[model samples]
Target: MFKFNETSPRKCWLIGHRGAMGHAPENTLASFICGQKLGADMLECDIHLSKDKKCVVMHDESVERTTNGHGQIRNLTSSKIKKLDAGSWYSKKYVGERALLLEELLDWIKEQKSCLGRALGLAIEIKNEPIRYLDIEKVAIEIVKKKKMESRIIFISFDHGVVKRAKSLEPNIPTGILYREPLADPFKRAKELGADAIFPRRHLITKSLVQNAHKHKLFVVAWTVNEVKEMKKIFTIGTDAIATNFPDRLNRVLSNAVKR
Candidate 1:
């Protein structure tokens, strides 16, 4: 059976957020390669639909924040968006690194699978909020199925409907709901939506949330936690996975946990 909850032989899964943004430019291939090198069990990337309806791997609706270009991803064609210098903002060494397609990332992952001896689960956060991409879930899932990588993917989105639609289309694919707000009952909400995982804001992760989520057979993957002190707290709370910008730091913490 496919399992996203279990991180056996280790206390928790170390997921690289935006491909270890702390080490390399977020969502760039260098970042993903760095994440895998640093021992991430999964690598996270954001997705948005370009003007021509191509799936682009990025965290923002606009390219201004992370790239040399300035425009909304939905407004630009994939060819236009893909040509931007996505790495220069981070460092001169990465100046020529261009933005990538979801397909490109999948291909790289496939190439790395044999070398690493493990396929990293991709925590694909569908960027549908603040600028909804029509039919994005279908577009995204279709690529995963085409690559034969549905078994190694997890669809997460702040928009509940996105995950719901994705699950409705492919029941075997694992889905997770992301929320920063306090919900009356998240586990119930996830169960109703057919999501087996919950990606809650780190602060909202209480002991009861983790325990009850597991009680309901749902898993919890906390988001973007960077500080070591906070990491230890989340570890104490027992999240299934802790997504972070520094997978190396998280790996160190997990190693120390084993030592103690």
Candidate 2:
């Protein structure tokens, strides 16, 4: 897995927020590939169980937002979800793109690694909010284990319990706590949750939060920062990673920052 180097600001990974949502539809294979082509070091996506208990990629429990289909993800089987056009809502060029199963993505990543001689990281966000997927952590982690891609993954979730469940199931895979509200001693709480990192909403990030997290040997990744100015500001705060929809833009900013 590509990790951050404290001495090199440019090594702070660009985690593609929903697979470079600014360029392609969120959470589809097309989006993930676009992120990689645009210079993202890690592809971040959300996962939920299908009616048949297969792990599928999509950010919501419902497919309506990013798909040309209707119904809750858990109510639909994997085969049914696979037929849904997951990219048309974003652009006509991506009309035929379908939602992919987790295994399919893992296989693609493996292929990419062989072809490029480098591992591309994946941050699978466990979508256990508002509704829970039964045994999602075990199922997802089991799939990663089957593919032997544990080292390249970092599981994250707003529901800290779900993230904790991931740790209990697969101690080898690193986990992170996702929070919208600022926590008291963010690094300490993340460690309490058995997480190796903390993912804070961009507004919740402060210099002290990054400093304290680094002090505890925990890393901070700020999320959904799109504007160039905001990206530069977050970069200046010493975060280990920045999750963004416009990874291409973030790449340009980081490149310029490096030159200076």
Candidate 3:
């Protein structure tokens, strides 16, 4: 099995989607902290470049929905972007939450590492599509390399071109091609891009697809798996990892189902 992080790969890996979004606020620093506390082995987050080209941890192309700001994320400078309250929309308890810089999130994960005694992996997904934020992959590479997280960070993207760009910069770092549908020749596409992993939307992940990806020596990962039934199905199909909003729940369910 591919070892991600210094963490033992023995346990079924738990990857928190947007960092334990079910318990705290999605994609906020607080949510990530909550995820770590809830026994998440790895944290998954989306990356989008600020107008000034700094990588920030967020999933949306527009800021109007997630933050108090009103514009496309590509249109705002990091300074202006930082000032918006990112949490109040979720609840009053999270009133002052602000967008987190990728560097800050990395530092937080590193700190958690010291206590967990396991290298926590980060599934960093590139959010720029339709040719916006042309330099996002470059900025993401610089951050991952600088932090010495090249081994543990799995770079994934829906934009296959972005994944290709990342692989070009550093082939050693694992890259996953994220897809919403089961392509007719998924293995061929992954091989062409030099992708180490194939991440498909949860429902689309089947035993045949998993087997097909493995034929090309690619690891399989699935996203947004939050239910015990779905989680059980994915586990039986044998994915390398799963991105989930409810890591703790899945962990317990998985443990029970397997034990029974």
Point out the worst 10-residue segment of candidate 1 by lDDT: 110-119
User: Considering TM-score, where higher is better, how would the candidates rank from best to worst?
Assistant: 1, 2, 3
Please list the Cα RMSD from the true structure of every candidate, rounded to 1 decimal place. 1.7, 1.9, 2.4
How much is the lDDT of residue 192 in candidate 3?
92
- What local distance difference test score does each model get? 0.88, 0.86, 0.80
Tens-place lDDT per residue, model 3, 16-55, is: 8999998877889989988877767788998888778888
- Please estimate how well model 3 matches the true structure, expressed as its whole-model Cα lDDT: 0.80
Tens-digit lDDT string for candidate 2 (114-200): 112357889999888788888899999999999999988899999999988899888878999999886767777888878988999
Candidate 3 lDDT trough over 10 residues, lowest sum: 1-10
TM-score of each: 0.96, 0.95, 0.92
Off by over 4 Å in 2: 4-9, 113-117
Best by TM-score: 1
lDDT for 148 (candidate 2):
94
lDDT of 1: 0.88
Residue 69 displacement (Å), model 1: 1.2
- Better model by lDDT: candidate 1 vs candidate 3: 1
